[model samples]
Target chain A: MSKLASMLSTIMILFPGVAMATPDIIRQQLPQSVPHYWKWGSLFVNLQVNYFKVFFLVALLAIIIIEFLHFVIIGPKKFRESGKKIRVYNLFVRIVHWTAALSFTLLVPTGLIIVFSKFFGGDGFVRAMRSLHFIGAILFAISVVPLFFMWVLHMLPEEGDIRWFMVGGGYLTKKEVETGAGRFNPGQKIWFWIATVFGTLLFLTGFLMYLRKPNFVIPFVKYQIDALRLAAITHNLIAVIVLIMFLVHLYMSLFAVKGSLKSMITGYKDEEELKYMHSSFYEKIKHKLNE
Target chain B: MYKYSRMKFYCDENRCINCHGCEVACQVGNDLPVDIARRKVITFNEGIEGKEYSLSISCMHCTDAPCAQVCPVQCFYIREDGIVLHDKDKCIGCGYCLYACPFGAPQFPKDGAFGTRGVMDKCTMCAGGPAPTFSEKEKRLYGQNRIAEGKVPLCAAMCSTNALIVGDAEHVSQIIRERRMAHGHGVLDETPYGWDIAYPNE
Candidate 1:
């Protein structure tokens, strides 16, 4: 009888589903460490931390170095604003621009530190950077609303943009590229589009990772892990593009073009430069470009 | 040459009295923040007679540690003896480890503006981190290094019922097996949760 009992227990261990079925008392407390979805999500995290970070960081450094050398090689343009100032950017436009710019300025460094802090900092350092990044992400997401609404209509890509692209939008080649685009040039339109699309993506992904749970999974998405993983990968990829475009925009507005910074600051552009730079748009808004 | 024995910890639920002495001892020993509980005794069916059982949980310091694998900073390291240790200096507190750990061993103190995770804190298995052995910095960051002193961990040592056991994996299991034989039959989580994931031995 004892030998039969021992044999029965061994068989019971084999078909645990049939034999040692979950007792109610222990059901809720079984240590569920890793399920399939968690492991799948982990793959995305692996890619994000390893591939995206290394690749984008390299690209960021390369862009800064190349742009700096360009400045050294070809000293920025000396477009004298013809002394006839016209109101190109209204107060609303200026406000949105500064808000986006300031928020971006804070976001970039803090975001990078959050990613790379493990390489350099301790608990205290990471804590500080994480806090800063959270604030910056909120400001960034909020600023995008005004920025998109303000510039979306004006940034529609016109027919001339194709020609502008061929000539490198006057950014690549030293010679002038005649775009004759509307209020926003084709190059500017491209920047605006990239920023709008990828900027929104960054915000979404940033928040998903920030929330740290299942509160914001994509609707109708059966696979929560897939959606979250996609978010993680997409955010990293778009962040690289956003960083590049932001640098280019900053350089052009601040140094590459002489009157560009003044126009944004004062909400006015030199009438002569405006006409020469945005000839077609200049035609549409000339009358509106008040003295 | 054989390195140190594979370090491991086992908590017998049958012997546990739900005293929470392990949790309190760890917090006091580590000087961890109130919000951070390096060790927690999770009690199931608290008031229900005969169904009451508590599990003292913390980092298992797995052989194939997921935290070490997933850490972007590569902060976590596994000693030859299979004790997992992480460098605080290299931890970004991104909470990747928290998500990856099967035991939920990695913990983050809530600190950032959006309740953002602070640096990860977990059981060091009584072994200090990368800091010089027995140094004050290591003591402050990783709690006591009793293993280096040839002593049992405070959690197990302070267990009034001797429910928590910590030492070499082989020796600990042998002891448990002997007890099983002596007692005929009792509840046992035969495979330490996540043991295969940590130390595949494959």
Candidate 2:
């Protein structure tokens, strides 16, 4: 389509959001060259790259925290008590875990290549890096899709989990803390919700930024750009906050309260530890095991 | 030691015809894309009786540019000759410079289908791209940098009325002051000449 026609349509679509339709006003206020490109086209792509970087950064932190809790915080204590028989992650969880983990790691560096390409110019290596980055971002986005379902079954909060949150989940102080959190604590549930909401926003906003050809419409470009900027800010902020939370979660699971990592790692907790830490669930599972 | 001073752009309002000649001069000389102009004409009509004066606005290349101060990465740098330049590598595309510049100079390319061009492009005073000397990459990203080749900007040189003059700061300032003194307290002194004074409010 002709540039002017496309520009008119694009402006018409975004007209409701901003006062852009009055050509007289636009002519007066805008520089003659201002609309040479679409209203907010460049800003849109920038927001996309930034948002993904934020998402990957947060996911990486979450992985690190979950692993740390297993090895350092809860692992040693579990080993001392049960002598290394518990497994925190099952075989299926491990497969999904790694697929998502690898995808997340690949997304950041790849996405950065495209975002930073202007500085590097169109040099061969830079172009190659950006191409790879987009591929990695797609992989990461695809891998995250299944996590919602996996989490749907595991991350729901019960009344007991709410109580766990009320007492600060016994994370703040070391002694006199009782363990009553179920399959997932209220804290983990909250992170799951964040991952779902912000993660979806990041993916959809990111896809619009690509705006690849025949599939994407021109009029939505401005909207895509504005929404993308907001998504980027939200995505990055969540990533940073989530990273810190994951670190704390890791420490608690592996060593802080003891025997927590053993449950995920070996798929079992000492009978006594289970009785104290997850009495209600333990009783139910134990009764089933006996039957 | 390198000397530090404010960079400025001066326009002789009396000479401008509001023809937008300067705008075309800048775009063609710099090979800017279809819709971008490094220079522009702004017109104000008042006092009836068919009297209106047009002012051209672009990068003032200020001595204390707001773009430089607010940039988070400190990408902007002022040359010893008082020309402002920035490293595209360090730029984060935050658009803070747009808010800070008294005379809006920074220009960003439109992001199209071939992925977004994250780098910012602007008038380099006809000195070409970020790279040294004229090369294909620089030409593609920025227009020619003729000043580096010991040439005056095409826009200033092409001004039919000599309204735009690009040169050492003292010479241009002297020329404007002389024109104002010779013309006396008429439209030339007030219109495009003193337009910068009236610029902040509008």
Best model number under TM-score: 1
For A210-230, candidate 2 gives per-residue lDDT tens digits of 321112232433322233334
TM-score of chain A, model number 1: 0.79
Give residue A6's error in model 1 in angstroms: 51
Q: Candidate 2: how many backbone clashes?
A: 21
Q: Which residue pairs clash within candidate 1?
A: B64-B198
Docking class of 2: incorrect
User: Can you tell me the DockQ of model 1?
Assistant: 0.19
Chain A TM per candidate, in order of listing: 0.79, 0.57
Best by DockQ: 1
Instruction: Write model 2 residue lDDT over B1-202, tens digit each, in one string.
Output: 1332333456665678888887898887777765455776877563445666666777666565556665545667877666777876556454435434444456544442134334456666776646667787766666777777788777777888887777775566667777777777532334334334322332
Tens digit per residue, CA lDDT, model 1, A1-291: 755654464445333244332112111232432334355556765775568778778878988898898788865766654677778789988888888788888877776766676565546666677677767777777788889998888888787666666655566655554556667778688788887788887887776555443322257544433444566667767887888888888888888878789889999887666665676777777677553
Per model, the share of native interface contacts recovered reads 0.30, 0.00
lDDT of 1 by residue, B69-133 (tens): 77767788888888888888777777667645655567665554456555678898888889999
